[model samples]
Structure formats: structure tokens, C-alpha cells
Target: MDASEINAITDWLIDGARSAPMPSQMMAQACERMVAAGLPLWRVGVFIRTLHPEIFGRNFIWRQGAPEVEVGTVDFEIQETPEFKRSPLSLVFNRGLEVRGNPDNLADVERFPFLLDLRQEGATDYVAMPLRFLDDTVHAMTLTTKQPGGFSDAQVAALRALTKPLTRITEIITLRRTATTLLDTYVGNRAGERIMGGQIRRGHTDTMQAVIWLSDLRGFTALSDRLPAETVVEILNHYFDCQVASIRAHGGEVLKFMGDGLLAVFPIDEYIGDANHVCARVLEAARESRCSVDALAFPIGEAIERFRFGVALHVGNILYGNIGGGNRLDFTCIGPAVNLAARLEKIAGRMGRTVVASEGFVRACGADWNELGEFPIAGFSTAQRVYGLADEAPVVMA
Candidate 1:
């Protein structure tokens, strides 16, 4: 690209970054502008590592005349895959290398196995540019050419010059996305928005009435001791699948995942539902989650056939917001109701029940709950009444 064309592209990208364009659109626009500037650009791709649990990274592909950029994702298992080990992206993403390949040279075969196939597909030269972020993390951008003579030294120099603004534009886009991901990953969506919306002062809280739910794996301590670490993690994830999906389906927001335990709440708002409606929502989720946990099938030789979980439901006024010390902070709920919900989980397991509801929940829900008799919770001075749900829940709980 010439000096004037480079300036124009940089201005366009910097302006686009301000408007919060998609990552793929930024890459595609850069490719379009570079080709307009007399650069023999055939394809461009970007590989950026992100902070998602399942997605290891994302890829943005820009071809000559595609309507929009074709996108793909790399799963967490990418490092162990043969496809990752064989590609030029692997060298850049793993070894932090800046790779250039010319298909005309047979010597490139040992270095890039993809060179042979790309050569047949009309690719003459390939260059991978490594972009370094302020955090010291390296990402890659691959640009390919179909020209006969490949890229001249001057053209490669110009391409290198453009990498700076290109990196800035991508980092701008990535930073926005990473913030949302980190918030969503560490905190619930509702709480994450409060944080991003500038409600970050310590002790910023909201008092509300909601149905609280707490679930715990029955034998996690013993299971962790008996199984390998990896096996234990997998089992925990499987168990969570049952709890999270059911809770979300019934309009419950998952608040936290405390080791083998899960905490969630169904907010009772005027527009969403009344107090009785909220209770029924938690009961339905409890029934579905219990069935889901029981249906988990393991291999014949596995330690256990299926996971056993105890779920407890309670309802009362609770304070939901940021709570912690100077160093560490957590956005969660805390109150006497929250403590009672946890205590009921232990009582459920001891009584051989998969689901248990406190008097507050059962009464507010107006559902027919079989009384499990009064039990003395550790912290409470007097005994409290606890109830369990039947196998089949009626159509209407209220």
C-alpha cells in the first residue's frame, strides 16, 4: 500500500473502532482497503485468544467477495487436536512465531503442511503477522497472496507498517468483548451490568424478596477423594448442566457456583410474577433438576451410576449485591433466608430426599408439600418445619 492509502485505511479503522464495529467487519474492511491500495491480497484471517470457558479462541476469515466474513471458533480441546498442530496458526499462537511461506519453494513443505493444499487452491505466498497486546499476549493475523511473483520486499514492508493500526483496532474491539465476558463469567449477568454501569462502590446493595435455591452434590467430598482431578471436574460440570439448565428455563438466575454447590434465585417482580408465581417457578425447576440429575448415566465400571444431589428452596427478604473485604469482592446474596436455604440442603440429604422446601417457600408457593417433620437447624435456636415435593408435581403449584 502507498503512504496515502495507508493513511486513509488507518483513519477509517480508527474511526470504525470508535463506532464499536464487529471484529470480523474490522478485518474485512482492512482487507478491502489494502486490496484497493494495490496490494495483492487474496485472504485474511485473525486468531485471538479470549476469556471464555469453552471457546479457546475465535477466527475471522475475509475472502475476496463473500457477503460477510465467515467466522469460526476454536474449542478448549484445540491444543490437543491434529488440525491445530499442523497449521501455521499453531506456530504463531503456540510458539509466538512470525511465519512466512512461499508455495513455489518445495522446501516449505516440512514447515507448513498446508502449503501444498493452499498452492493448489491458487495461493502463491502466505504471511502470518503477530500482534502484541499491552498485556504481553500475542495474537496472529494471516494475509495470503495469489500473485505470480509473490510479495515484493517493499510490499511486505508496507504490510508490516499497517500492522500497528490493525493491532490497535482489533485490541479496541477485543477489550470491549473481553470485559463483557469476564463480567458474565465471574458474576451473573444482572450483577455484571450493575458493575459495568458504574455501581462498583463497596456495600452497594438492593433489598428484595425472592425465592432462593441452593443445590449440592451428595457425595462430592468422597467422590473427589476417590476419583482423579480431571474426572472430578467433568463430573461436576455434568451435574451443573442439570441444575443450570432447569433453573434458567424457569426464569431463575444462577447466582454462584461454589465448588460442588449451586446457588440461584427467582426474583419476584410485579411485572414478572407474584410471590406465589415465583414459588411455583422454583418448585418446577427443583422437580426438573432432580429428574435431570437422576438421569445421568455413567460407564459400567465408574464409581457411581448417577449423581445424587440435594436441592433446597426458601423465600424471604434478602440483600443482593457486592459483599467482601478490601482485596477480594463478590456480588451475591446474603441474609438469614440464604443461610436457611443452605441448611435445608444438608437436611434433605440426611433425610434421603432429593428436594426439600422450607415452610416459607411451601407456604408462599401454596403447593401440596409432604411434611418431613420439624428439624433443628444448627444456627436456629428452635426447630423449623421442612417439606418435600412429591414425585409428580401438579399442573399448577399455586
Candidate 2:
């Protein structure tokens, strides 16, 4: 690109980044730019549903003003990668490489279905830009031209620069939306059979067996009141990041974050692995996460604040799935089990404990527990036996 063209493109990029629209809106703006620049079509997809990076990475094509590829559909496709061929965007998504040009000449595209679809749809020219942060490859951006040969070198370079900043904005938007989605689902009790993200078993009732996990930040509401909005957001986001990493690493699905708390579940059935193993792993992860939080308080040159968390786990049958009317639906868990989990969380707070599980859950865990005696939880009539997973360390709320 010449200096003038480079400057113009950079200006456009900064404007686009500054606008910071929703994903759908971002795609719309992207397509508008491509069309204005004389390209025929444009696409932006993130490969999240597919565990295997090689399949269709999160892919979307914006033609004209419509959102041809919606987020839900993209997530489904990612989760449903077949046993045979993986999606084409997998190359750029998993391998950290930018793919450009037509598949007939780009050997990698010769075997990809998404490319074939684009080709069928009259997208002859293509360019895929991989966004990499540090060593791990997060996602990719693909731009298309309907002309027979795909994008030109100049066009590809222009699109690449345009999308680099735009891609980070997209990632941030994705994470925020994902967090919001989980929160809505759990809070509304709409998450059903697919509670923990494994495939829905054919013929199985939409019902699911789950280990409901509720985690709350001690004094979060107060902290929010005392701290600046930006500071509050940063602290909660960092805390949530730690919790989410721990939950996913231990094979649990984080359902939501309600103000200062989190809801997660271990759908043993969906996990397909040993339920006990998964539970043990998640507990270990929780301890590690707590330790991580503690370590963060003293590491840097600046003084750091410490935070405490309360966690409660309950295993029972709960209704799960999408809930709501029209466009406001949520994917979340429902039923007495969810309520009981939350109640248990409250009990944990009263007892000044970090983690607690019911007697039934403790028995299922097959681990020795230090009993906290029968306690009358506010919402329940009978006193329930709660136990701390104190096989090693004592439980303290915070």
C-alpha cells in the first residue's frame, strides 16, 4: 500500500475500532467497507463450537446488509464437526497462518468445505487472516471477493490491516457476550438438557442430571459501591477470568455470573468422562484458582487487593435449555436444584466457609468431609447437613 492509501486505510481502521459495535453490527460495517472498496462479499467467523480447530473456524459471510451467518448457528456447526473432514478455517484458526486467494490455487483450500461453499456462492477470491496473541492462536478473519480469482495482494493487505484491530474488538465482544449469555441462562433457569455443553443425546428427555455450582464474591456489592465503575469491572472481569479458566480446565461449564457471584455446573452425563474424576478435578481447580487469586495480591510493583469466594455444589435433576419469548430467550438451568444450590451458597456465607456441598453430594464425591452440623437454610424447612471438603485445608468463607 502507498503512503496515502496506507494512511486512509489506517484512518478507516481507527474509526471502525472506535465505533465498537456488536458482532452483527461489526459484520455489517465490515461488509459495507468491503463493498465500498469494490469487493463483492465479506465474511467473519470464530471457530468456537468446533473443539477441533481444523474444521470450520467460526465462519460468517455478510452479503449486502443481512447477517447470513448468525452466532448460534456458527456455534452449533463448531460443536457438530463430523468424524471425516474438518472445517476449512481450521488451518488458519489452529495453525496460526493467514489464508488468501482461491482454493483451486491455494492447496489448503482444495479440501475445505467452507471454501467450497464460498466457491459455489460465487466467491472466487478469498483471504483468511489469523489473529494471534502471544503463542496461542485465538481466531481468524476471512474476507472474500466474488470475482473468479479471489482477493488481490493489495486488497488482502488492506483487509488484513483493517481487521487486525477489528479482530481484537471482536474477541472482547465475544467474551463479554459469552459471559452475559451464561449469566442470563442460569439466572432465568432456562438451561436444559444441554446444560454442560456435551451433545444432546437422541431421545433423551430435555431433563438433565447436574452438579450445580454457585460461587459468590464476598462483599462484591459493597466493593462495587466503593470502587469506580471501571475498576469494579476490571476486578470482576479478572476474577471471572480466573474462575472460568479453572472451570473449563476441570471440565465444567460456567453457566453465569450474577453481579458478584457465578453459577457453573458439571453435567456428568454430557461430560462422557468419569463424573467423580471431573468433580475432583474441578475442586482441585477451585483451590488452585483461590491460590492464584492470593498470589496476585502481592506480585506486582503496585499494591494489590485480595478477594474471597464462596462456593456451593449440589447434584440433582434440573430443567435446562433455552427459555424466553421471541428474541429474549436464555439457555440456563431451572428447578429446585438450582434454588437449593443458591441457598447452599447463602449458608456458606453464614458459616464463614469457602466451599460446602450437601451430604448427598459428599457421599457421591466419595471423599471424607468435615461436617458443619445440621443447619437451617432460610428457604428450606428442614435442617440440612452440610459438609466442607476439608480433607486437606480448612474451609473459610471469603
Candidate 3:
């Protein structure tokens, strides 16, 4: 590779990096250009650390003649296994050193088993370089060739010359992916997009009618206190799985989790049926929640019955967006109906009901529910009416 070839690859990479929406696409183009420049690159792999709740990192692999990049994710357990310890990527990440191994050629050192496997597959050279970020943490950039002579000094120098631009391109891609992963992990997808679209102002809110869904374990405090700390966490996660799966399956976005409680919303947009579709979604979610929670019992016979929980659904206008103080904020709903939903859940057990809702929700759902009489609620100037969304017979209480 000469100076002209290197310059052309750098220019093409700089231009393509800006237009590519995905990191894999940018990498694919770069690999194709490198191979075109007479660099016998048979396979290329890059790994990046990201800010996702469940994902530790991801690997993007490009092979000759493949249309695009193939991706593999690194999870928590994968990071701890012995398989990662003996790999070139692990050495680069852990020791911040460059590694070159060629098992096919005589007199060349081959340390890891993976390199030997690559040799058997016709690879003549394997080189892994440490990709550093602004924070100084090392990721990975690797290359392999199947040519008989392997990579010449000129080819390696050309790759070394592209590091600055490579770092910039990958930095942009990783940061973009980090922003989306963090936002989607913390906030629901739609709400996260709204926030990302410049809705971070403290007073920024939209008044929209949505069905509010709030639910919590019936005896979470007692359950947590009576059980081991580890058991408590397991129980909480199990309980959340039951609610979250149901809500997401019904097109509801889980907005927040307050210890034992979960808050969600099914926003009703411009399109409206005779009865709002959001109501049925919330009802369907509630039914699924009730059934699933029933099955989330302790594996043992420690308790006479399964764990219990209650859900409250109400439809009304809400001020949804950023709200808080001291430079921190919460992107959540706030309105009279929000208060009413929580208060309804507070009395659900006393009323011998597992699921309850307001008249507005009942009307929108087009369900025959027993109406609960009006009652004075805290933080409210007047009494509020309610209705039952329970599967059982009516059991109204004060």
C-alpha cells in the first residue's frame, strides 16, 4: 500500500462515516476499500463497549464476499468465562497491547487456540490492535489475511496510519449507539425519542388523554422483610417480569418503576375509535398481569397461597414530560387522574378486588363494570368516582 492508496482509503472512510447510520455499514465499506487497496484482508472484527442496561459490548465481523457485517453481543456471563481469557481481544482489552500471531507460517508464534483454528481455515496472519477512547479504556480492532505471504510491513503501516480517522469514526458510532441504548433502557422507546427530540426542559409537558396503569405487589414490604435479601431481589424481578411483559405485549410503555410499584401509560393519539383502544390495551395488560402474578408463587410450600398484587387503571388528561428540581428531573405523568389511580390501588385489597379502574376507563373499554360510589381522596378538593375492572363479582367498600 502506497501513500496514494492510504489517502484514498482515508478520504472514502471520512466521507462514508458521516452518511452511514449503523456502525456495521461503515465498517463494511472500510473493509471493502482496504481489500481493494491490495491488502489481503479476509476477515475483520471490531468490538465496542456501549451504555446498554443488559449488553456489555458488541462485536462486528466482516468476511470476504459477505454483503454486510455480522454482529455478536457480549453479555455478563460471556465476559466471565474462560473462553474470553485466551483470546486476542481479551489481551488487548486487559493489557492494552498489540498481538500478532500466524500459525500457518513456520517460525511465527501462535499463542491462542483461536489463531490456530484460523490457520487451519487458511488464514496466514492475525493482528489485533487496541482501540482507545477519550476515557482511555481500550476496545478492539483486528484484521486477518489468508494470502500466502501474509501482511507485509507496508500493509501494516497503512493500517497504523488510519488509526486516527478510525478512532474518530468509531467514536461517533459508539457515542450515537450509547445515547440511544441509555435512553431506551431508562425511558420507554417513544418517550425516549421525545426526550431526545429536545423535550428536556423542566416545564415542558404535553396535556394528553391516556390510560394510566399502576400496580404493585400486595405485601411487598412484609415479603421483603421476611425473606432473604437475595430472595427479595429475585421476587421483585420475577414480579416485574410478569407486569412488564404484559404491558409491552399490549402496546403500553412502562414509564417508571418506584420500588415495588410500576407506572405505565397507553397514550391515545389523534385516532380514536367509538371507545378508545388504549382502554382495552390496559385491560388486557391487567388481566395478563393478574394471571401471571398468580403463577409467580414461591417454588416451595412455604406459603399457603400464591403472592398477590393489585392493578389500577384510569383514563384522563395528564401533564406528561420533565418535572423535578435541583438539576435532576423525572419524565413522568402528573395530574388528578394519576393521584386517583394510586388511591384506587390503595383500597383495592380492602374492596376484595384485584383490578380496578375509573368510569372514564370503563366507558372507553366498553366493558360492563360495577360502578363504585364516589369517595373523598387525599390531595383532591372533591370526591372521585371509580369502577371495577375485576374478573370477580362486585365487592365495593368504603
Per lDDT, the best of the predicted structures is 1
Q: For candidate 1, write residues 243-345 as lDDT tens digits.
A: 8988888888898999999999888885655989878888888888878888997653645557778888998888998888994788999998899999998
lDDT of 3: 0.81
User: For model 2, how does the per-residue alpha-carbon lDDT over 1-398 read when each residue is reduced to its tens digit?
Assistant: 24464555456555654553566666666566556656555454544322322233344555554635465444335435651235545667557677655655556455564666666676677666776633354576666666556666666666667666666666666565555454434442234334345423432235778788898888788778877887888888777876777877777777777887888887776656466765677677767777766554522237567877788988888886666665565566788888888888888887777788887677677776798889876767888898886653554544
Candidates' RMSD to native: 4.9, 15.5, 3.2
Task: Report lDDT per candidate.
Answer: 0.84, 0.65, 0.81
Looking at model 2, residue 343 earns an lDDT score of 86
Model 1: per-residue Cα lDDT at residue 63: 90
TM-score of 2: 0.50
Task: Estimate candidate 2's alpha-carbon lDDT, on a 0 to 1 scale.
Answer: 0.65
Task: List the candidates' TM-scores in order.
Answer: 0.80, 0.50, 0.88
So what's the TM-score on candidate 3?
Answer: 0.88
lDDT of 3 by residue, 214-238 (tens): 8888778877777788877878888
